[model samples]
Target: MKLLKLVPDDTNIDFMKWRKIAFGISLALMIASVVLVGVRGLNFGVDFVGGQMIRVTFTQTAEAPVAKLRDTVGALGYGSPSIQRFGAPNEVSIRMRLPKEAEGQTGAAATMTNAIVGSIQKDYPGARVDGVDSVSGKVSDELFQKGTIALLAAMVAIAIYIWVRFEWQFGVGGLAALAHDVTLTFGFFALTQLEFDLNIIAALLTIIGYSLNDTIVVYDRIRENLKKYRKMEIGELINLSINETLSRTVMTSLTMVIVLVAMLLLGPETIFGFTAAMTLGIVVGTYSSIYWGAPILVWLKVGPDSFVPVGDKPGAPGRDREGYTR
Candidate 1:
């Protein structure tokens, strides 16, 4: 039986021909993201900022709506708790920043949770607290530090892996593409003021893995073609490699995007930020694999000689008569 084909097996598209244009666009967007993040900052969630979070579920459908919950909580003098539907209509999560005086106070979170629960239950009978979590300022600071370290560590590991597996040029290109995907994803979160929590950090790491896998695939093909087509120009070889993997790339990205879109539209508000970030990452990752990752090889001056053994040259170290790196 014939297999399904989303992109032709014999594709010959010149993807690297427009590298300059694509680079320009990516640079502009990255700079804009940096500016937005610097000016507006991220909308950190309770996990990153000290806060008390309460999840409540109503036993009856006659419970108050979201707006009423907000109003009810607001009237309690907590300064308008951030209330939103959690997983279902009957479930809601209320988050409030800890007061200055309440910070570092023992058992403050539990006492606050009890008070909020009591206040809400009075208005809507059968309403009970499903979960309660509290983060202190010290804990939040530690979390932020660890999260940043994890991201940097992941990037460094990826760069080292690529450098060892391929040449330095390929490593640089892969890092560049990963950086582009990550920056754009962060930019999306910053521009939209999405909650920057641990889940979103997971999404960012997931994006790094996905984008790196795609870049490696392209780099592998380029490596093979460099040895086979010695006369081909670097630009032509890069384009050929991308076209060769275009079908697989499109299929993988499309499959991921379909699932991510479903989650974005139907998933709970708690994971909306996660799904949105993943969706953006998939799109950006695919584009960078094609346009940003492979095209950087040209700027790095990676030619056929780069892929050959150092000992292949006459009088080089570790020379061998059979042309193999002895």
Candidate 2:
């Protein structure tokens, strides 16, 4: 029986033919993301912006709890605290910016938390604070620094791994693609004003891994093709490798996208930012793996010599004309 295929197995696509256009589009969007970030800035969550977050659970179901909670907190003169459903329908999370008077005051977060809870208790007899957490400006800054460091470290590690497994050219190409994916993902968040918290950072790391995996698959095929088709030009070899792996790449990306989209639509608002980031990452990662990664090899002047074993020149001693030892 013939197997059904989403993409033809013997497909021959000239992916590299549109490299210039892809690069231009990617560059334009990346620049726009940077501008957006600089101008409007990120909508950082309480975790990164030095604020208080209180999770509360009500004893009974409440109608329009988000609006109720928001109004309640706003009436308390807290400068319009953000209130939204935390996880379950009965649970709500309230976040408030640090008041100027509370800044650097000892036990300010705890004092503020108690005041908020006490005020809410008057309206809802059985409502109880599930959890309370606070981040000072210094701590928030430190967390932001650490998160940035972690992202950079992950990218560097990915580059090093690729360099070890393949040629330096391949390593550079893979890293470029990874960077491209990450930048575009960030661009999406900036454009949409999604919350940039630790969870989003986690999604960014996952994107790097996903894009790296895809690029490595294509690179492996390119390496194999280099050995098999020694006479093929580097450009032709790259095109062949990408075409050979296109089906697998498309299937993998499509599967991931389907799952992510389901999560985005069905998951709770708590993870909306994460799911959105991941969804964007998958699409960008797949594109970079195909267009950005392979084209870089050509620009770097990669050829058959890059893959051939050192000292295994053609017709050398026991080696045959194909550089194989007898």
User: CA lDDT of each candidate?
Assistant: 0.84, 0.83
Top candidate by lDDT: 1
Tens-place lDDT digits, model 2, residues 1-326: 99989989789888888988988998898888888878877877666779898889997765336666777777877565766777777888888867767777888777777788998888887887888877778888888899999989999898999888888888898888988888777777778887788889899999898999899999999988877787899888899999999899989999999999999998756688999999999998999988899999999998876765555566554533355543
TM-score of each: 0.83, 0.85
Q: Give the lowest summed-lDDT range of ten residues in model 2.
A: 317-326
Q: Write the per-residue lDDT of candidate 1 for residues 211-285, one digit (tens) a residue.
A: 999999999999888877879999999989888888889999999999999998887565788899999999999
Clash numbers, per candidate: 0, 0
> How well does candidate 2 score on lDDT at residue 215?
91
TM-score for candidate 2, residues paired by index = 0.85
User: Candidate 1, 83: how far from true, in Å?
Assistant: 8.0
| Runs with alpha carbons beyond 4 Å of true place in candidate 1 | 1-4, 55-95, 98-115, 129-132, 312-326
Among all windows of 10 consecutive residues in model 1, the one with the lowest summed lDDT is 317-326
